[model samples]
Every structure is written in C-alpha cells, then in structure tokens.
Target chain A: MTRILPALAVAVTLSSFGSFTASADPLPSWVSSGTKDQIVEFVTAVTTPDSTDYVTPADRIAVFDNDGTLWAEQPVYFQFIFAMDRLAELAKQDPSILTTPTLQAAAKGDLETVLQGGHNALIEVVNASHSGISVEAFQAAVADWLDTARHPETNLPYDQMTYQPMVELLRYLRDEGFQTYIVSGGGLHFMRVFAEEAYGIPPEQILGTYANTTYEQVDGVPTVIKAPGIAFIDDKGGKPINIERTIGKRPILAGGNSDGDFAMMEWTSAGEGPRLGVLIHHTDAAREWAYDRESPIGKLVDGLDKGPGMGWVIVDMAQDWSRIYTGAN
Target chain B: MTRILPALAVAVTLSSFGSFTASADPLPSWVSSGTKDQIVEFVTAVTTPDSTDYVTPADRIAVFDNDGTLWAEQPVYFQFIFAMDRLAELAKQDPSILTTPTLQAAAKGDLETVLQGGHNALIEVVNASHSGISVEAFQAAVADWLDTARHPETNLPYDQMTYQPMVELLRYLRDEGFQTYIVSGGGLHFMRVFAEEAYGIPPEQILGTYANTTYEQVDGVPTVIKAPGIAFIDDKGGKPINIERTIGKRPILAGGNSDGDFAMMEWTSAGEGPRLGVLIHHTDAAREWAYDRESPIGKLVDGLDKGPGMGWVIVDMAQDWSRIYTGAN
Candidate 1:
C-alpha cells in the first residue's frame, strides 16, 4: 500500500497540473467539445453559490449507469462474461452443476444459444453461477477471477476496461460535492468487488440487481448466503424505482447509455430543478465498440430517439472521448 | 432557513468552545464515565495514525438502530403511531378504506386491539394507510405528521423525541470520518422525511423496513407509488442481511437497544478489526420509558443477557446520560 502511494502521487500531480493550467480541464480525457461543455456547464450552474440553478451539496446527487455509460459493454455485459467464466470453471469441477439447457449452454460458452433462451434462461445461468455460496465466498471468487482474467479483445484486466473520461467525471463530480452512485443492471456483489477500486464509488453507493440472500449461522458464524434467484432486475423502469427506493431523492443528474437507463434520466429531468441527463452513445469503433440501436447488450433505441428531445446531452463516444481507457486510446 | 442560521451559528460556537476547554467533552449530554470513555477510546484507536486498529475513512462504517436506540420508542414505535394516525385520517375521508378489522382497529385508536392482531395485522394497518400514494406525497404526509404529532407522554413533537447523547455521538462519529447509517424496523419513507433534520443523517444513509413500491408515469411524470406489502422487515436477522446487501461491508460500530439489533452487532463484532457494540439500555423511567424484556416494542432480553460477554458496552440511560433530549434535562 505504501509503495503504491508514489505512483498515486505522480498521477495526482499530473491531474493537478491540468487544474492549474490557464485552460484547465478537470476531465482531461474528454475532448473540448459540446458534450464536455454541457457537462461542465451543468456542474458549474449547480455548484455556483449565487447561481439561480445552484443546488446544495446534500442535494447534488448524480446517478450513472455502469455497463455502457461508465465502462465498455461491447459484445456483452462484463458481468455476464464473469457468470459464463464462473459456470465454465464450475462445470469443469462438477459437470452435474450444468443440469439445465441454459446452464449447459453457458458452461459451453454458447452465448447465442443462451441468449435465444430468453430472460428465464439468463436468470438460470446467473443464479446457478452466482448463488448458493456465502457472500464472502462469492466475493472472494469474483476477486480472484478479476485478478487473473483479462478482456478477450482488449487483453486488459476486466477492471481496467473502465472508461477514462467517465472515471474523471466521477472524480470531478465528487470534488464539486456531488454524491456519485452506480445504478446498474449488473450483479450487485460482482460490481461491488471492483467498484471502489476501479470507479472510486463506495460499496454502499453502488445499487444494482441483487440476488435473494439469506442470513444464517454457518458453523456458528453469521453468514449471508446468496440464494438462487434474482430479487430484482434493475433494468429499464427498475432503475428509477431502485434509485428512489435506495436514495429516496430524485437525482439532479443522470448518465446512462441504453433504454434501460431511460426512466432514470427521465426521472432526473422531471425534477423541478437544474437537471442534466447525459446519454453515452457508443459511436467509437476505432477505439471501442460502436453498436447502438440494435446492440445485443446496451440496446439504445429509446435513448437515441427521445433523449435529445428531453434536453439530454448525447455523448458521441468517438467524437467526445480523446482517450477511451486510462493509459490507452 | 436564513432565520434559523443564527441559532445554528450560536450552537456551533457553543460546541466549539467545548473543544477549546481543558477537559471538554464532545458529548456533553453523556456523563464522563466508562460508557463515554469506551466510545471515545474506540474512535481514537481507529483514527490514530500509528494505531494498529487504525481504519481508513472509507471503511469506518457505523450502523445504529433508529427506534429505541437513537430516539425514544416507548408507548409504541413512532412509525406505528404514524400509521395509526394516517389510517384515522384516511378513514375520515373514506370509511371504505378501512375494510379489515385491523385497519378499523387502527382507525379507532384501539392500540390494544391492533397489538393483539400481531405482525400480519400490524402490516395490514400499515399497508392500508401507507400504500397507493406517490413517494413524494407520502414524504409530504410524513413531514406534516412529524410537524404536528407529539408523543403522548412527553407532549413533544415526534422528531424532537430523539435522544441528545445519541445525536451527539452520531455527529462525533461523523467528525471522526465514520459514515453513520440508520438500520431500523421503521417505515423507510417515514424516517427519511425527518432523518436529516432530526439526526443529521441524510435520506440515503437511513435504511428501514420498506414497502413494495412501483414506478409509473403518473400523468407525464415518473412517480414511485407505495404498494400494499412489506418488502422487507429490517429487524433481527434481516438487519445484518440488509446491511451486507446495501453497504456490502461489515460496519466497525453497531449501536442499538433491542434483540432486533443483536444480529447486526454480532456481525459487526465478528469482523476482523477493532469493533464496538453499544447497547443503549433504557433504564431511566423518569426521563424516558424504561421497559425492556417484557416490552411490546424494543424488547431487549438477549442484549442484557449476552451483550457484555460479547464485549459490548451497555449504556445505562439512568446513569450514563446527563441529558436525555436536546434542550431538555
């Protein structure tokens, strides 16, 4: 921990240099474009003390979707990849665990076959791979997997696949007294393992689809074991509902990349205050994946069609982002 | 808000003066005794730079039960009172809403009858009164009720019934970089309404028993409406389960007054670190209600029987508190 401080110090110094410059940019990875300008303007308006649009520190809540908005979700949602990987490993140990068609498909890495089986099949795969273990054991498994696994295409560690500009935006918002949260359709426990380290958002702030967990005394020690069922799938309308349920406040700003996040951004826009809705458009095939409207993961029809009319800033990833990931372009 | 600032300024000045004194106490409402010393020592050890128990700011989580622990919950849990009052109000407008015996009993202020009906009946009354309302509308109703409603015995506003020492402890813990959260069996929306003002805890930090709410476009705006059913009862084993589900980390400190909080404290204590469990034993009948084991609400037999053995500090309200409520002896 002490040894890593020097590297962190150098990074901070480099970031601080951008802040000290005449034309300073807190989000240095974001291009000097309309998208960046809109984000900066919204933050400035809300944070400026004398501005009519000014919001208090406590009310300065911002919610961002995890998969596509904050990080890359190209061929599939990364959590699904984790589930498939986990299932494959489990199947190798005990082939009997892949009892169902979907579980077997997932174990065989047949993404198309599993997707064709629909929501129930997806849930079966997820539950089989994710549940029936203590939360601590599951967390340990996720941590271990993340440490060794890399993105098939990027060859980068899965956690390192996070968007640089969005990471900077999160830091910038926190600096401006905004409470940043991840309202995702991803697995809660899986995201929690890396959210703090990768995104600088704490465990409590990351709200996502969670499994039904039971509290029991396992070997006389209190343990929360993940049960084999989805308690809630935080997608589409579920995003806003979970946001209100957890945060109990309408976020002033919402950032997302798909139809799943449409309601959240809509809710944020409906609040009678200075609100901003940012939709990250995956239009960068050179640096990142560019499938949108008809994408298997992160489908963006509603967001692409109705977002602009709602005064939401649609981020053209290829145009707006100068750097896709940290230390990479 | 401007009118209240001068009073707030004076309170801050007065509180600051204590820090400047030779033997000043941050928790002046608490007696300078073992209980107070223990709390201070635990915080100090975790905060000190070179201490073996030094916890980072992000990991310094503290959870407290809201009902009997942070505030007074004597005659009945305040949320039950709120539910009863709400039912009565609704029944006045439309008597048909009181379809069940439980609802009718609650509407008529028959506390004994309502209590006799048990958990399902209690839930029925709550569901009847609390459901079919938007989150914003429900919050407004709770805020209005809190403003007008007073404790039957003390005749003070329900929000003001919060214990002074506990409030100070919350502030002190926050000052020492601990993120304080309320984990209680109270209505989530009800507690969220006044939590910030009453206890300095933000809405997001307050976790409680929640109803199943549905999100819909009421008119043209996205609205979260409370539906009729208890989604969770955050008591006993559920406390630790919800804590892990929401926070994803075991708290360093757990504070409560009843057996409902036993699992939470046990979970906190079981974590590998310097942890503290504080049981607020309501032993002062003169200043506050003192029923424990035989009490309908906030029964504390397990806490009394096993807390000390678990290294938990038992706070005797009669002896430990110099002041019970703020601005009252």
Candidate 2:
C-alpha cells in the first residue's frame, strides 16, 4: 500500500482542526514542531526519494493499536460500559444477568469492584454480554447501543471522545495513500460498527480480535452462524503477529499508548528501513486525564523510557495535540 | 457503502462497420432485433428506478468465480501445475516427499495418475503442496512462480491470460460502485498471490477454499503455520455457504461459467433485488476452444436454462465479446 503523502504531516492537520484545504497545500499548522517534528523526521528517513529505507507507497504499511493509541481506554473499556448498559436494559426481561458473575459485577457498577477481579472480570463481562447472540443480532445490538450510548464519566458519546489526533493521522495517511488498519484487542465486530463512520476506514480494513462464526443452511438459503470461538485475539503480543499473518506486510509506522502496545511498537521498529515508532503519553489532566506508569489502564512508562532518541516519538498529549475529536455533527 | 455516482444505464453500442462499443446506445450485433428488444426490456425492468427489480449500489454485490471465469483453467488448475513445479524444485532437497503419495504424483508430473484415486487424489495434492509451508513462504513462492512461469498452453504467463472482456466488465462494475470479491475453489493463499494484481482486489477481500494454517514461534518471531487440515472447499454449493460465512452479505451480481459456479449464480439470483446473472458460454472454438457437459472443466448447462428469462445474460463468447485476454507484452 503506497502512500501518496506523508502520514504524520496529514495526521497533525487532521488532529488539530477540521479545515479542508486544497490538495496542493494539504499541510496544516500542526505539521511542524514538537510531536510533528519527530513524526516528520521518521517519515523523511523512510520515504525520502533515495533513502535506503525508502519504500514505495505500495509498501508503506502502517498499523495502529486502537484502544489507548486511537481513543480513550480508562477506568473501564467503553465496550464494557456498553455491556453494563445492555445488562441494565436486558435486566428488565432477564434478571439472571444480575446473578451472572461478570454481569453481576458490572451491574454493581463500581470501578474498584471490577479492578478487584482483574482480567478475569473483563473477559467474563465481555463473554457474558457478547456471546450466545447471532452475529447480526450482536452487530445490530452494538449499532443500536452505539447510536445513543455515551460514556457516563466523559458525558460524550464514546465515538466523540476518541483521540482527535489519531483520527487525523489515519485520514492523512490514507489521503497520502497509506493503508491504515485497526489492530486491537477490542472485538473486531464491535469496532466495525462505528469504525467507518467515525474513522472513515471500512470494516474490511479493520482487523482485530474476533469470535468464530459458523456456516449452515437456513430455509432454502445458506446463512452464517455466529458462535463464540476465540478465533482471533488482536492485542498485546498478538498485535504484531496478527498484522503480519493477515496483512502480510511489516508496518513502517506504529503508534500505541500502553504496555499492551509495547510489543506492537517494537515490532514496527524492528522492520527494515526508515521507521516511525510513537507513544501517545497521556499527560493532560485538565483537558484530558494524565496517568502512565501508576495508572491501571494505559501504562506507558517503559515505552517512554525507551523512546527518547531511539527513533520513537513520545507525544505529550497535553501539549503536543491541540484538539480532542472532530465529532462531526 | 454509499456510492457517489448515480445509476448509469447499461447499454450496448453497436456500429454499422462491424465494430461495437460494448454498450447499448446501439444494441449488440449478436442480439437479433428480437433478442435486442428482449434484452432492452430486461435491462429496463432491472434498472427502472421505481421497479421491484431496481437495485441500489449498496445491494450491488458481485461475486465472481475465478479459475475459468477470469483466467484459463485448462491443462488442469494453474495451482496444480505450480505445485508440481514446486515439488520437483524442492524434491532433491527433501527425499521423504517421494514416499508421500501425493508428493510423488506431483513430483513425477503424473497428475492424472494421482486423480485416479479420485477425492483422495484431490486431498493428497492439496495437502502436499499447501500444508506445512508458512503462509508467507507460500505467497512468496506463488508470486515468484507467477512472475516467471508461462502457461504451457497459452505461452503467456498465467496472469497475462485473463479474459479481457471480463476484466473490462469487472472494472465497469467496480467503477459503478459494486463491491466485488473472488469466490473460488482455489486455495486461498494461492489465489492471494495474483488476485490483487490480476483482479484489482486485495488479498483480505478474497474468500476461497482453504487448508487451515497454524501458529508457531520460529526463532523468536511468531509465524503462521500452514497445515493440511480438512480442506475448506469453496466449490459448488459450498460457494454460497462460504460467502455467507465470510462476508455475511449476499451478492446481487454473479458471473461464472461452470457447474461449480451454477450454485453461486443461483444463490445470487435468489436475492430480493434486481439481480444479474451472466453466463460466459464458450461458443468460440477458433480463438478459444469450446466445451460443455462432457468437458472436465467449466461445464455450463444448468446456468444456461435455469438462468435465461430470469435476467440471466447468456454470453455467446464468439459473438458477444471481441477480445479474449488483454494485450500482454
């Protein structure tokens, strides 16, 4: 996938503001200084007309970890919130969800209670909410809930609260001719719901963890059966593995914001030629929230320590980025 | 899935000096005055904006059977030929292949002898060539071989021998905003090699028959392991099942020219919108050889009758299409 333009430059413009510009002058104000400088330098090294790292637009592969890198992953994942809301909505009809461990813990609705149980609690909550339903029904349920759902804490629909800068980067890269994909631990189907509308990337382009689907004949026609199988887990160490296995290309640009994304960034940096590795350090508490090493969610200290001048850019979310989200109304 | 263009009328333009524009400004020469009228009426019904047969671009999903539909599938499947070459290439280095029934058959270039075993032959051939190779290595091998090898029958590289008229039709449909995908019985990995270059489709977009692959940690890097699992066949009735299982969307346009493709065309026509089923009947034996029910490849009987008045266009290859493969230099 050859990129027509530089991704970092385009991303800065997109992340900062939503001002459409003439194609000849696509660069924006945020294209220089701080975070943009690091991004541009990496791009230049890899894409310079005659640089050794110079790969044609056809090989300008870039993959991003969606959770913290592309959006907000805080006290609890947004999907978990969707599940809790679903549980409450379904509780009116099916009260046993109140007794299901994961649903019960979610119904309790205290962040501390969830952290007490750890990863087990998270997977349990997800399986309880997502399994059993047909893939269509699950997708419809997700789409319906996403249409009206808002994060209780942020007070904005989860789609809006997505990191504004990341969205710009994706479009900038795509406009430049780079193929941008979401490789995340999040349910691949869940991401497909708002991915295209919010990010403008199609469902086929987004690759993430997915439950297995079965095939069967229905009535006179063949219909697919959606079942819960651990078909894919596109997260943590799985990120790089999944990308290579599916896309069959090594990414030149990789951006992530947590320990979960550490391996993904490492994988990008290990690839040949001029490469870009970036970490979105959340240090803006007033505009956003700041916590890295000590935070339970999105810890990035290890990556930051490794960043410095190691060809990896550490973006100070508070200062480097100028806006939150485009949230197109 | 929203398209930017309005529905363009599908017309065949014919000229008085024995040339045709392949559009309907002046009907095709093959469609007699009566046949042309019938076709115009059918097209009118299908494309009428308010008719029960009107189909939106979103509903214009087109599924194409590869093999004989796109490129020549004569002298046996191109994949088998490649596998035979590969077996011979790698045979000296690995002697155990001689003991493997399928490997021996392929290595010896006695494919017909191998097929004497019937289903067992197909199983052995697929397992030997595909299984155990890393998906990446297999893709590389395919790309490498396709780049160098020429089809014995055509003397043109396999990719160069694709049907030109069909290629143009595919481009036309894509320009019209139809989502196109290859539904083939060929091994998924093998098709991924030239699919994008030949059909303008990405590998991830292809849904085909597959022998499963596993995951293994080679050295420190995790690599996908391709194994000879029970093959996932995407031929005949399996085509629709695989399509529904993978894409979960039904196609409105289906093009194929074999019994294996009949089930696919039937599946597409079953959709509730204005459907188009085109059968490429090889009526030309001069420019190209013709065969039907007795031929081992591309048998086109069922689709011819069952598909006629129901909006199916039976292409008289000799009369309807002017060019075969696009000029490959």
Candidate 3:
C-alpha cells in the first residue's frame, strides 16, 4: 500500500505531461494520420466548453469492447483460455473431470468439439469452470491464473497483450473527462480481476456477460454463490440492452472489432448528438494475427461493410497503429 | 447548462464555509450528538493518507438504499404510487384496463386487493405499466409523473420527500471523494428519471430493479424495447447480489432501513478493514411516519435487532434528525 503512493505520484506526473502535450500527441502509439485525426477532433469538439458538440462531463460516456478492441482476441478469446486452464486444474484435483466428454475435449484443446456442443455446451463449460463457488474464491482463482498466464504465441503475460494505441485512447478519453467503460462479451468476473490493473478502468465501470449469483450465509459469513446459469449476454443486440440497463445512458463514443458490436455501434450512433463509432479492423498479420469475415471467432464482416454507411471510423490496425502490443512494436 | 456554473460556484463557496465550521457542524440537519459523529470519524480516518484505514479514492464506494434510507417510504413506496398513477392514466386511455381486476384495484387505491395478488401480481403490474414501451417513452412517462405527483400524506413532491440529513451526508461523502450509488429495489428507469436532479447522483451511478429489454430496429430506427418480465429484483439478498454483479466490490459504507437491507449490510460489513453500516430507524411519528419492527412496507425488525451487535449505527429518526424532509422540519 505504501509503495502505491510513489507509483501513483509517477502516474500523475506522466498524466500531467500527457495533458500538456494532448493537442500535439495524446495518442502517441497511434499514427499521426487517418482515424487519429478523427478521434482527436471528436474528443476536442465534445470537451470544448463553448463548442456546439460539447457534452457535460457526466454524459461523456465512452464504451470499449474488451477482447479484440482493447487486447488481442485472435486464436481464441482470452476468457476461453482461462476457462480451459480452470478445466485442467479441476481435472488435476478430481480426475473424474478428465473422463467427462466435454471436459475431456476442452482439456485436449479440441475447440471444434467444444463448439459443436453449441451455446449449451459453452454454457456448460463456463458453469463448470466459473460457477458453484463463492465469488471471493473465484476472484482469487482468477487473480492467481492471471498472475501466471501467458499468451502462447507471444509468451507475454496476458495483460501485456493489450493494444498500446487503445490504451492511449482510453487514457486520453479519461483525461478529456469521459468515463470509459469496458462493455465486453467476456465474463464480468474474469474482466473485473484485471480491468483496473490492465486498463486503469475500475471494476464497476466494466459491464460484461454475467452469471446468476445467490446470496447465502455460510457459517455466519455472507457469501455470494455464483450459480450455473447465464444472467446476461453482452453481445450483438445484448450489448446495447445491457448498456442501457446498467449504465442508464447511451455512450457518446463506442469502439468494437467484431460484427457482435454492430448493434452497440448502431445504438450509440442513433443518439441525437455528436457520436463517434470506431471499429478496429484487425489487418496486421505481421505484428499480430489478422482475421476478418472468414474467421470463426471475432468475425468482423458485417461491421466492416456497414462502417462507411454508418459513419463509423474503421481503424486499419496495420496502418493506424504505430505500435501493437504494450511493449512491442 | 451555463446557469449550472454559477450555482456550482455558490455550492463551492458554501462548502468551504461548512468545512471551516466542520468541527461544530458538518451535518446541520443531523443532531450534533449522534450517529453523525461516527460517520464523520469513519470518513476522516479513511480519507486521511497516513491512516491505517486509508482507502484510495477509486475504492471509496458508498452504497445507499433509496426508499427508506434516503427518502420517505411510508404510506407505501413511492414507485408503487407511480405504478398506480400509470394504471389510472392508462385506464383513462384504454377502458379495457378497467376490466383487469388487479389494475382496477390499483387505480382505485385499493392496495389490499393489489397486494393479495402476490409477487406475480406485482410483477404483472410492473410489466404492464413499465414495459411494452420504448425506453425513451418510459423515461418520459416517469418524468411527467414526477413533475405532477405528490405524496398523499405530506403533499410534497416525491423527490422533495428525501431526508435533508441524508442529502447532506451524500454531499459530504462526495466532497470527501466517495462515489455514491443508489442501490434500490425501485425500477431502474423510474429512479434514473429524477436521481440526477434530486440527488446530484448521475443516472450511471444509480442501480435498481429492472425489466428485460430487447434491442430492435423499429422501422429501421434503433430502439430498446422494454420486455414484459422482471429481469432483476434489487432488494433483500438481491441488493448484495446486484452490487457484486454491477459494482464488483463490497461497499465500505452501506445505509438502508429495512429487513431487506440486512443482507446488504451483512455483505458490506463482512469485508476486510474499516466498514460502516447504518440503518435508518423510523421512530419519528411527529415529524415523519413511524412504523418499524412490524411494518408491511420497509420492515426494520431484523436489521434493528442486529444493528448494535454488528456495530451498525441505528439512526433513530426522532432523536437523530433535527430536520426530516428537505427544506422542512
């Protein structure tokens, strides 16, 4: 706790430096061309007190999709990795899980078999790995997994796999008085574990897919037990619905990668104001994995085709981002 | 929006004056010698940088139950009034509603008949009045009702029925860098209509019971259609459950006034380190309605009995408050 002060002081100093140079380069990781200008122009217009597009600080909500938009989700969604890891650990504890067909398929990295189970199979995997445990216990498990988990391709800690340009954009938005939130398709509990540490966004500001939880007293201790059922799915149409129910306001700015975020972008752009819709087009095969319409996971075909018509900025990751991963170019 | 600047300046000036006189009176509406002291002490210890109980600004989450804790709930919860009002209005437009026995009873102010219909009946009424409408339409309806509706007993607007002391406490907490959230059993849309204007808390910070909603393109226009079903109930055990699901952290400070709040307080207090639980006991029959321990609505028996043992401050409304309603004694 004491060490946190010096780190905070350094962050404050860095932030002050960023603010001073905001007009010149708030998003240093972003190229000084293309969508960068649009982002800066939109942010400036909304933040200027006398500008017609100026929005109040309270209403300056900006939502970002976690997976491909903020971090690399190619190969597979990070939460799926977490789920698979949990299955392996469980198999070690109770060898019976290794024999279970679906669990066995998951353990062998046979994603095709797992997906064949369809939505129900996916829910089964999520429940088996994520639920029937106390929330505190789940959080601890996630924290421990995150501390050690690394991306198979990069061998970097999963948190370090976050996009540098998007990280800068989040910081710039916050500095410009916008409340940034992670409206993700990933599990809420999983996102909460590292949201603050990785993204500098608090857990409360992160809304994601969730499971039903029951409150019970266990030996005079109050505990929230995560149940084996989906409470909400924050994808496609569900994104906009969950945002409205949880945040109670439409975001002024929304960014996502896949077609799943199409409704969210539409809902945001439909608002009667100066709204910005950003779609991250993953086209950087050299720096990162490249997938679009043909990909099974995080398909971006619909959003890409609709981007121009909807006035959404399609960020060409290969062109717009000067840097990809946090510490890599 | 321009007018807000001067008003904010005035509030800043007033707050400075209050700070200088903080030792004498920080909460003028609250009695000088009561739970007020405990609240101030807890806030001071947590906000102080060097104190062992120090909490970062980001972690200073303070949850408040809306109905009985922050505002009056006697003569029935205010939302019930809104629901009944909506029923009457709908009955005027469509005479068919008159044939619905429960709605007819609600329109006639026959709460006995309405309650006899049980939880399912209550859900039906909520969906009838709140759902099957666009989110924007429902918000407008709530706004219109709040603009004209008055408490049957006090003859004051429902928003004005809020406790002056609690208002002060909210302001005080905000001044000390605590983010305040309204975790209520009332409808989320209903609460959002007036939460910002009445409490200075933004709609984004307000969480409440909500109905299922669907995102649809109504005539090619993106709209969220409120669905006919209870999505979440934010009361009793539900309070803690929603808090965890939404906020993803245990509140350090929690205030409520019913048996429904018992689990919320327990969950909040169960967290490690400095915590404060406050139960607003309705004991002021003269200044405000007084019915606890056996009241049908906002029952306080379990909470009141266990408050002292849990180190929760049970606020006796008669003795603890110098003023009850905002701008009234």
User: Using DockQ as the measure, which candidate wins?
Assistant: 3
Using Cα atoms with residue i matched to residue i, what is each candidate's TM-score against the true structure?
A: 0.93, 0.76, 0.93
Whichever of 2 and 3 has more DockQ, that candidate is 3
A156: Cα error in model 3, Å: 1.8
Candidate 1 lDDT, tens digit per residue, A1-329?
A: 99999999999999888778636678999889988999999999999999999999999999999998888886778888889999999889999998888888899999899989877777888889998899989999999999998888999888888999999999999989999999999999999999998889999999999999998889988888999888889988899888888898899999999989999999899899799999999998989988887777788899888888889999998999888986366
lDDT of 3: 0.88
What are the TM values for chain B, all candidates? 0.93, 0.83, 0.91
Tens digits of lDDT, candidate 3, A157-197 = 88889999999999999989999999999999989888887
- Candidate 1 lDDT, tens digit per residue, B271-311? 89899999999999988978889987888999899889889
Across residues A1-329, which tens digit of lDDT does each residue of candidate 2 receive? Answer: 24745787789889666554533322242435567866766566656678876678877778887877788887667887886777667776887767656566676665578677877777666766676665667889998987798777667778887777778778777766678878777887788788888888766567777666554456765444456556666777778756654566678888888887777777677666677887888888876788899887777776877766457888887777777655621
Residue A237, candidate 2: Cα error in Å is 5.1
Ranked candidates, highest lDDT first = 1, 3, 2
TM-score computed on alpha carbons, candidate 3: 0.93
Error of 3 at B289 (Å): 1.0
Worst 10 residues of 1 chain B by lDDT: B17-26
